[model samples]
Target: MTQPLLPDVRRPANGGPKAAARNRAALIVAAREIYAAQGLDAPLSAIARRAGVGQGVLYRHFPDRDALATAVLEENVRQIEQAAAAEDMSFADILGVLTWHLKESAAFLGLLHMRGSVDHSEALAHALALSDRVERALRERLPDGHRLGAANDLMLAVAMVSGAAGGPEREARERRAMAAWRLLGVEVGTVRPFDA
Candidate 1:
């Protein structure tokens, strides 16, 4: 594959591949924490400070703020995928996992939505691919109901969570939406044809 548009800085004498990897990981963690506390508009310098790394180190791993946000979001999506794939997890369980991630990563999600048009286009593609995979997996486990595909219901659930603020309000909003899905029979571990 072609090289990414943003490349890391060349390793110095004291820093090798291992150091680069560690720095990259640290940047992601710091970005998540900083973003959660201060929103996506928080300065990149703040994230660098939180990671205990210099601004140059942060820039080496992620050339721009969008790059950093994408890295954080990619990690979040991977985690949600793993949660959904857990043994015996129902659709409701999967939605819970998804919303929880969404709530926690609201800043990143908002950043993506606000910067939807351009910039970080590749990251946007990767995020969409990850989401599509999860949705397809969930769809396979859901039965056709009300002539709607599982993906449709999944989108609606996402829309519901999109309006939610962080903290208890987020959980409450997701719970209400899940309850509505239950009423509509848009869940797994039910009398759906797939389970029969």
Candidate 2:
């Protein structure tokens, strides 16, 4: 038999119920907000209460906060992958996608920088795979003169603040975003100066 163009991989056949996706997504958001406010010490029961779902229902969907946290990150990763799917964008446009990703996902990054782990290791693995896709999109989007090194630099710059500062230090984070813009080749310097 001739080999097919792409390798086959096994995954869940079911995407799950549309309503369930919405509901689980809501639970993930609620957990993130509560966890951001109180860290992981916040009770799952309280999260269930805040989510307006019975404890069993919450457990059925997430089983534990670990699963819930992973789900949140996964959702963000999915969006990033989707947005960066374009392979023909100009370097600047591609860079814009990176900036928008980490900015819109500031809270998600905050959770990651703060929480750092989830029970299901596979979730984090999937997140990283999605990141690779983002990088690929960036490389494909860059102009003829652009070096891959710039893409790496942009990734680091975005992480420098969000992955480092996170939390109530809103001003500093904004500085990081602006710095990231500059690093991505925009001429503007730190719009609001601040230390890392």
Candidate 3:
């Protein structure tokens, strides 16, 4: 007899709606880890294996890589929104959260640059809206002479960090991000540490 694709221990016998939800959640967590360690181009099969689900289950949940990527980005946005909601989180703190996400997730920078795609647009919109709020807060905190040159300067700063975070080496990436922060006139000491 042929062996089942998923071990009996991994999948409940009923395999009902709850199982589907569990499989989807597992796939997202697995993809996030795999992508962070191996970049966005990591094979879908690896994600399936890591999630302990069959490839068909993965395809059912995410028809394509962009779909999966959008889901991951949405989760990241949710975390950022949560962090932003903290009463004491300063504008610099928000930037730190954004920078941390970009540095930690290989898929993040690539997906953020995919501006025209409808699949990822909603998550991107939420992230940009969060950035807008941060920019407003920053404006309030800065003196007239230190104000940003344009409405999108915060976005530019984020792009710089995202670009720097994609460097070949981790230490180099951190150094480059710091340099970009300094060039943008953001005080590195004011921003929260990127670890975690």
Candidate 4:
């Protein structure tokens, strides 16, 4: 009896191009959670596990830690851009979003320090654009006589919020960010003059 040989059937790899977008989204979400919980140096394997994907899928989406961090930051910037685009959202509102992200994601602060790296250039550009947009909104909202040094003051306010985000406790971080915003004459939920 001659037995016919059956053709070998192989399953497609986990992260085929069809799945690349989905896999990448999953990886980014996982990275956000893992990084927020364990900081930027958290194991890549942990991210893969959290994403329910394999290491190969993670590598395919993010070539390295910096690449993943950049993606995470880009996502953050995208969020800020959305807030900036809202007609009713004030500069203070956008700053609140930025501070919330910084407080929740340790990687955001870590990657902000890596602005010198080429991998983060896109995120940096987007951030700078958002900064310009927010600055414009701030300028528009400022008292007519207080427009002087608006740009410098906005940058200082951002720096203060970022610096305050390094604290270990969430409540403390929020308090510090609020104080910094107040020092810059911007309130968390409202924008007001320094003396007002």
Candidate 5:
């Protein structure tokens, strides 16, 4: 018995169609690995392999690499909604959670670097509505100072930390991200271990 050498294109039998978000999310995560290891040179077949799905499933979910990359990114930002999970809190708590999310998104940033495309403009635009919601969430938690700047800084910082130019190396990116976290009033790592 031999497995098909060719990319499997069929989806697993599902009597009930899974939610699009979930299916796409699995594909997106798998694609991220493919893109990261291959640095956008990864083929759809490669992604299918990494995803443990069929080529047909890959194609059905994402028509091409660009679409897959787009989906990968969309999932990245979508992951940030957890920042608002700590509803009804002080500004400090709100900032703390958002900052922690910045680190959480670090892996996604690596994926973005691997994708190496500037197609996130549309995604960013779409996130604006959510951005407003996020800002409002932060505002609700803050007091007189009410630094809405944290919202802006957080978005940019996460993007920067995840971006290629954000840091020369992983350690540097972490340090920079933590610094940005502090600036945004988002609590993060207490001290650089290097000091030890």
Candidate 6:
């Protein structure tokens, strides 16, 4: 069956009415992929195409690029929260989850760096708060003497990973992330063989 061009734009903003929520979720998923692949300057039309929706439907949910970017960050924050809250997750696991997110969402994280210019103040605040929560959880999981340093190093790791340019710098980025873990005195290649 052929997909609809756009979500039924007639739905409400709460994303409550099933169809609207589905469209919103699809747009978010598409936006993440598009932004990461094409950079933040990518046209909204491209995002709409990727989401298999019309531009109007995309606008209905995210009035502007910043709005869509905000949604992406919001989702990233949610993922981090879930990882941090996982009871079975160890410190290394949490760090790995966060590091992987940083690598995957490097472009979106760049949007976070453009704090003042973007109209995503609320979203930025939410992301920052979530990051703090992740760091706090990691700190709590750290061995007694390593807590503070580990937390500090994790933050540094985020900066390093987020600042990296993809493609040629991909290896460098991975190295820097692992190096930050090493800075925390966490043994790399033990919990995960990330020696690459």
Clashing pairs in 5: 8-54, 8-55, 9-55, 9-56
After aligning candidate 2 to the native by TM-score, how far in Å is the CA of 54 from where it should be?
2.5
Residue by residue across 4-73, what tens digits does model 3's lDDT show? 6875465446778989999998998899778877888899999999999999999999999978876777
**C-alpha lDDT score of every prediction, in listed order:** 0.63, 0.56, 0.68, 0.68, 0.53, 0.64
Roughly what TM-score does model 2 have, to 2 decimal places? 0.58
Which of candidates 1 and 6 is the stronger one according to TM-score? 6
Candidate 5 Cα misplacement greater than 4 A, ranges: 1-16, 19-23, 36-41, 85-172, 182-186, 189-196
lDDT of 6 by residue, 1-65 (tens): 99769865675355457878888989988887777666778899999999988999999999998
Estimate the overall C-alpha local distance difference test score of candidate 6. 0.64
lDDT of 4 at 161: 69
Off by over 4 Å in 1: 1-15, 88-90, 111-127, 140-151, 166-196
Please, what are the lDDT tens digits per residue for candidate 4 over residues 46-83? Answer: 99999999999899888999889878877766666666
Q: TM-score of predicted model 6?
A: 0.67
What pairs collide in candidate 4? none
Total clashes in model 3, counting residue pairs 3 or more apart in sequence or in different chains: 0
Q: How many pairs of residues collide in each model?
A: 0, 0, 0, 0, 4, 0
- Cα lDDT tens digits, model 1, 87-166, are 67766566556555555565535533332346556656766666666566556545456334643655555544454434
How far off is residue 163 in model 6, in Å? 2.9
Candidate scoring better on lDDT of 4 and 5: 4
**Where is model 2 poorest over a 10-residue stretch in terms of lDDT?**
187-196
Best by TM-score: 4
| lDDT (C-alpha) at residue 19 in model 3 | 90
RMSD of each: 10.9, 14.7, 6.0, 6.9, 8.5, 7.9
lDDT of each residue in 1-196, candidate 2, tens digit only: 9977887778756546975776676787677556655665678887778887778878989877667766666665555455445444445544444444344444456433432455446755665555555556555544465443554564454455456435444456556766655554553321321111
Model 1 RMSD, rounded to 1 decimal:
10.9
lDDT of residue 177 for candidate 5: 63
